[model samples]
Target chain A: MKKIQILGTGCPKCRKLTELAEKAADELGIAYELIKVTELDEIMRFGVMMTPGLAVDGEVKAAGRIPDVEEIKKMIA
Target chain B: MAECCGGGNRLVYACSGGADVGEIADRVARKLVKTGFARPSCLAGVGGHVPGFVASATGDVVNIVIDGCSVACALKTLEQVGADMTHFVLTDMGLKKGRTPVEDAVIDRIAETIRIKSSGRVEESPASTHDGCACGGC
Candidate 1:
């Protein structure tokens, strides 16, 4: 199972990123655990200075803006 | 003795979103500059992580961030770039998010709020010596 984490303080864009990430994961039919890292300290541990960061299996795949679903699917894959 | 933002100690960022409040934030920011209340700031530059903008936001000067409503786009962008800024939300100033008409009175009121932080010249102190002219250039 892949662990997908979205890092942010749950801002509007962060919530949007989570929604997109879930859509991508469900379509792939991949057994994945989705997590939202909202705590500032925890988010910083990933070395992501920007909110709306996407991480897969402990590795940061994207940061800052909301990536499109196609790009997110690729990241999860 | 290098100058940042044209040597101005006050910087203001407006929420340039696509809503009534957003437009109010933007107009208020421009009006502030026009009246010498603050220097202009780029919300996009801060959000995009531009080094120059980031430096100013986190610099010694005070950065005033204005948002149209509770969405707080300008404030968040500044936070992302590690900019410790003073913030003002228009809706909090009695302007309803969708109903407030954008006008000079509204813009001036918002600008006055930010201007208060720097000095007491809410409407600019009258000339020390009034020039006796009808042009009102005193």
Candidate 2:
């Protein structure tokens, strides 16, 4: 199963990104697990200097902002 | 993040920063809950090291992390707690980080993304019980 993680605090953009991710995954018909990372210490461990990041299979792909759906599909695909 | 069952009860957390993208993420999360896509979870609880919150986050449901920028503060939080997440970033969506104008079209696009993602999952049942934590005060 593919693991999808959304990293951020409980903010607006973070939540929006979460929704987009779900859509992309469903559209692709891939089974994925989604997790939210909201702690400061935990967030820092990923070496992310910003809020709202993206991690796939334990790897940080995007950080500091929300990505487009097409880009998200590419990341998950 | 609180874990329930299926995407209906899936937890969503955002960076909630003071920037434009942050606001967008926050708004999107609210819209997702209103539209019955996923249940809004507490990001602070996970950040504050609340045991119950952490325990709830561990399970079979989807946990979403949304961030406004590349700092990925929210993503790091979950990682620190040893929890996995399906992450998204606004900057990656072609939205510039930092101060920017919030547009309705942008918000609509974000909402559409969420709807598309949750299309095949269990639709949030109308009879589904609401814990009333959408405000994250729990």
Candidate 3:
């Protein structure tokens, strides 16, 4: 199962990223675990400074900006 | 160090290029560290996506980025890791990139400029983003 981690402090962008990431995963038909990391400390542990970061498994694929659903599908797939 | 004394960590990263201004930027960052204005951190680590290094740059800490020229490699690297930073460019301070002399006096002047600006509100770099790069022939 892919572990999809969203790192953010619960801003609008963060929510948008989460929604997009979920849509991408569903479209890809992949089994995944969605984790919301809202704490600053935990978000930093993922090596992400910008909010609304997306990580696949344990590797960070994107930070500081939200990638579109197609882009996110590529990240998890 | 007054700004960072009672606050979180202040990490300094310099562009240390192969030019004269690069040397000045490096020396200024070292001076900042020596004078306790900030702690020296690794730009290479952040570029390589090292988790610990990236984490250190986040949160309540202050990431001070000094670039030698308009290339802004140091600033770009930290930005990839989502670091919020105050940036400076030596060339923007009237120092020519290749023509400038790498003197302690010059380094001190630039360092003082950084110290003064950093002590108060953060100054964003004029060319802060990848879009600012004109290497695409645009």
Candidate 4:
């Protein structure tokens, strides 16, 4: 299963990104676990200073923004 | 921040980009509001030159601009519309730029930092609201 984590402080954009990620993953028929990261120390551990970021399978794939649906699909695939 | 009285309310606008830092900033803001630490304001309204948003951004209510990168999209948007705000930048918070893995612990740390800086309060653990997707019609 693919482990997908949305790194952020649970803001609106973060929620939107999570929604987009879930949709993309489901549509692609990918088995993934989505986690929301809302703490500060944990976020800094990833060396990320921005919210609404994405980590795929323990690797930081995107940071500081929400990726478009097509791009997210490609990332998971 | 004071509650939205009359036609104006305090708000927070995050530059939620495609990168990890951007995502983190966006999520932190939402979580803060949901948890009662802050309120999610209107970014589009400020960007669109809405008078209500602009007026609320001023005065006593706190207008926070959280930006994922130094590009400062959120701050710029508020600035363009003459909205005064307190700002936080992920890059300035000491997170290195570039693609990095997203970790729950890291996010916690970011939220904690904001909590400390803004009001010296740590966030309580989030409740098990739901595990379904936001698009699941919840």
Candidate 5:
């Protein structure tokens, strides 16, 4: 199963990003496990200073802003 | 030490998080740039690994990270990318992260601390040799 991680520091944008990611995943039938990376140390390991970031299988695909459902679907797809 | 600090290859980054101390950190960085203590630089670039920002941060210039609190956002951003840098945290400077006030006096003090820390370490320009090469290393 593919791993989808939302890297953030619990900021508002981070929360919104999570919702978007979950919505996208649900619609795509990706059969993926979604994890939210929240700790400062763990977030730092992803090297994202921005509030919200998206990672697929440990690879960062988008950061700093919320990508739309279609864009996120493409990223996870 | 020079009375006025200026004209160096220095890059500065500030966490600028939403907390009160984050405001202080951001202001201090801007003050350093306004006073010519260092060139204002971006944290996101280093975090994003943008080639230009990465190259600039790791170049021969001195790099400094000013973070709001122990969260060390600015410091970690540079450190994660392997960019050698010096850092200061507002909390370490005696300001509480959430309770600190973002005042002119506080900003000035932080900038001054940076100046004091930098005076002894500013790199001297390489001397030009008889062959007209200015490299510090022969």
Candidate 6:
């Protein structure tokens, strides 16, 4: 199963990112475990300074801003 | 340098761009540090997305951002990370972008102005929250 991680502090954008990531993973039919990292220390461990960061399998794909659903699909896939 | 007071720290970041006003902004930030009114932090690190630096920008600290002009590159950089900052523009403070001279006197004046204006209790940014990343754009 793919480990899909969303790094944020539960802000509006963070929630949006979470929703989009789940949608992308579902559409791709990927077996994924969604993890939300809300702690600053945990988020920083991924070396991301921006909000609504996305990570796939322990690797950060985007940070500081929200990526479109299409872009998120690419990352998860 | 002021005995590391208990009420959190005042972290200063300067634009330090290529222009003359940028130079002034850089010096002003340093002067604030030297006078013990604030501490110097890295704007470049935040801009470069260094995790530790970005983490440090948040929390119980006051972020003072200095910009060379209305361009506000430094402010934008911090904003990208959803940092809450008190911003200042040299041009808005009556310093000409290219014409301002980088002098200790000028730096001192600006630093004093900032120290005075930024004085008092720590002002919490309306955007700051326990969870952090309060930009609200998401």
Which one wins on TM-score?
6
Give model 5's docking category: incorrect
Estimate, for each residue in B25-91, the C-alpha lDDT of model 2 and write its tens digit. 8887777667666665667877876543554454334567788889988898888777767788878
Instruction: Write one digit per residue (lDDT tens) for candidate 3, span A1-77.
Output: 99999876565666788999999999999999999777666766665644456788877777656789998999899
Q: Per-residue lDDT for A48-67 in model 2, tens only?
A: 43335677776666654467
**TM-score of chain B taken alone, every candidate:** 0.78, 0.77, 0.81, 0.72, 0.83, 0.82
TM-score, each model? 0.52, 0.53, 0.55, 0.49, 0.55, 0.56
Q: Model 6 compared with the native: what TM-score?
A: 0.56
Fill in the DockQ of model 2: 0.02
Q: What is the DockQ of each candidate?
A: 0.01, 0.02, 0.11, 0.02, 0.02, 0.13
Deviation (Å) of B109 in candidate 1: 1.6
Give me the candidate number with maximum lDDT.
6
In TM-score terms, candidate 2 sits at: 0.53
Off by over 4 Å in 6: A1-77, B1-7, B123-138
- Candidate 1, residue A4: CA error in Å? 42
User: Model 3: what TM-score for its first chain?
Assistant: 0.96
Give candidate 1's error at residue A21 in angstroms.
46
> Please, what are the lDDT tens digits per residue for candidate 6 over residues B1-138?
111112224678999999999989999987876665665568888888765457556634578899999999999999988888899998998899888889888888888888778876453222222334522232
Every candidate's fraction of true contacts kept comes to 0.00, 0.00, 0.08, 0.00, 0.00, 0.18
Model 4 agreement with the true structure over A5-75: per-residue lDDT tens digits: 88666656668889999999999998899998766457545544334567788666665456788889998
Lowest-sum lDDT 10-residue window in model 3 chain B = B129-138
Tell me chain A's TM-score in each of the predictions: 0.97, 0.94, 0.96, 0.94, 0.92, 0.97
Lowest-scoring 10 consecutive residues by lDDT in candidate 4 chain B? B1-10
The better-scoring model by TM-score among 2 and 5 is: 5
Off by over 4 Å in 1: A1-77, B1-7, B118-138
